[model samples]
Target: MALLSDGHFHSGETIAQQVGLSRTAVAGHISQLSDWGLDVFKVKGKGYRLERGFSLLNAESIKKHLGNTKRAMIDVESVLPSTNTEMKKRIANARHELADGDAIFAEIQTAGRGRHGRTWLAPIGGSLTFSMYWSFPDGYQSMAGLSLMVGLAVCEALKDFGVDDAELKWPNDIYLQGKKLAGILIEVEGQIGATAHSVIGIGLNVCVPDSQYDVGQPHSDLTSYLGHTPDRNSLAAAIIKSLWTLLPKFTQQGFGPFAPHWEALDLYADKRIVLQMGEKRFSGIDRGVDASGALLVETQDGITRFHGGEVSLRGNR
Candidate 1:
């Protein structure tokens, strides 16, 4: 594991001879690591090495946090350009081979991104950005509000880590008081019919400092907010476990299943908020997400449900 994390390439024969095993055994180990979420490059005659060197997120520690769930389902990567990007590649590759239940996690995304072409500002050794890829059901159109559920998972993880004051902004941003703490980006892959893969990407400012971003939006991290960084391994495991427990239910009940919980975490719920939908804009009290995951706003005329697409929500006060 140390050699693998060192970012150096190792040939199956070299590793096998070192460990007193056959080249086949070394190759098997590489396969197992790939199955666990580490991206390994195999050059027929050259050998195997990590796509990049990264601080390994201990699988055993993550599994301990997972409790009883099958460990084989997740793929954890220590360093990735972007979890969402990696998952897209995985989905394309999986097209040739039939498999399901795959996820990609990264300690930090070198090029993490957010909704509407916004760059996800994450610094190495400071934050967590990971993505999960899942094949949802056909009628999963009912799960439109799934991002809200994943937001709840993040909040629950924060609560478990003693950051209970964390709050949820509409759609996907998590906040503390008024500062941004985390964000979520959900992207879908596949055609209108057949199997559709949903990639859920998350960015948590775990320890990012104020200097990381320019003057505009304020950002905070668990480490700075709490005076020390929370254990990344524990947090990653908690997130995976939460997603595993909630995703299946999300498939069955749609976003409605998690609406109430989402409401409880909303920092702007029932409060005045502004909806920045392109050139048009509206300000109203947020009634939280309706049954379909649309933002429900109680305007003077009545209630308006805004489906999340090409829009941004900001707390008025």
Candidate 2:
């Protein structure tokens, strides 16, 4: 796994020969890779190799960087169909199986999803696809601006990677130079009378090149935008650490403590902008977000605050 993760692929024969296993066994393993949601290619003459290799997400590597947070609850997978979907399934089965701060990470996700029912494109070795599973004691209603808070964590994590210019575009999109570089998707699953379980999914463009931005519009990657890519293990560790530190506060203070930081990084702050909310479109000056994490827009009618749901904030023409 480590050798494969170093950014190259080996044929079934090579892998089997190196590991002293039968080629048939190696072929079986390659076939089973898809079960973990990994896309593996098999060429009769050339053998099998990953389209692109990603630093394999391993428990020990991540846990080492995690330090004390490792005990908080973590699940690292080499590959997963979708971390968010997997967490949702786990939460449905039994919340107790995973702790309040549980997180799931994958090197490559075959079926990742984004907000507004959009499919998230996580080309092999291009980005980070991970989901943090959290159980909020105060319930979903109490943490009204939870998604915004998660966005704040993402912004902080990026800054730690030396991308201090990164900005947040409302709800939960990370941007650099007016282009999207990452996104956050929050899914809440709560029992009728029980606490709310949240799966905070973050898709970060770590090392994707400009040429690979076909799936989404005006997207940039941290490595391409920053000139160098930080070690994936280090970046993942920093993000997880910040998230673990902030989750407890978010549950307690909601978005109160994070409002200032979020406001500082608002991409559309104090600028005349257009907001797309479903079929209705409104033009307003971005007055920054409110205490509850809702976007406050100074419009022709007055100041309007929006909470969530397909709200697009863009600079006014």
User: Whose lDDT is greatest here?
Assistant: 2
Per-model TM against the reference: 0.78, 0.87
| Candidate 2 segments exceeding 4 Å error | 1-3, 7-11, 18-54
Q: What's the lDDT for candidate 2?
A: 0.80
Please give, for residues 224-270, the per-residue lDDT of candidate 2 as tens digits. Answer: 87787677777888888888888888888788788888999889889
Q: Give the TM-score of candidate 1.
A: 0.78
Tell me the tens digit of each residue's lDDT in model 1 across 21-140: 788888787786665446789877777877656455666777787777755445667567788998888778855442344566765465678989788876544567788776776744
Top model by TM-score, which number? 2
Residue 120 displacement in candidate 2 (angstroms): 0.3
Runs of candidate 1 with Cα error greater than 4 angstroms are 1-56, 95-101, 211-216
Give the backbone clash total of model 2: 0
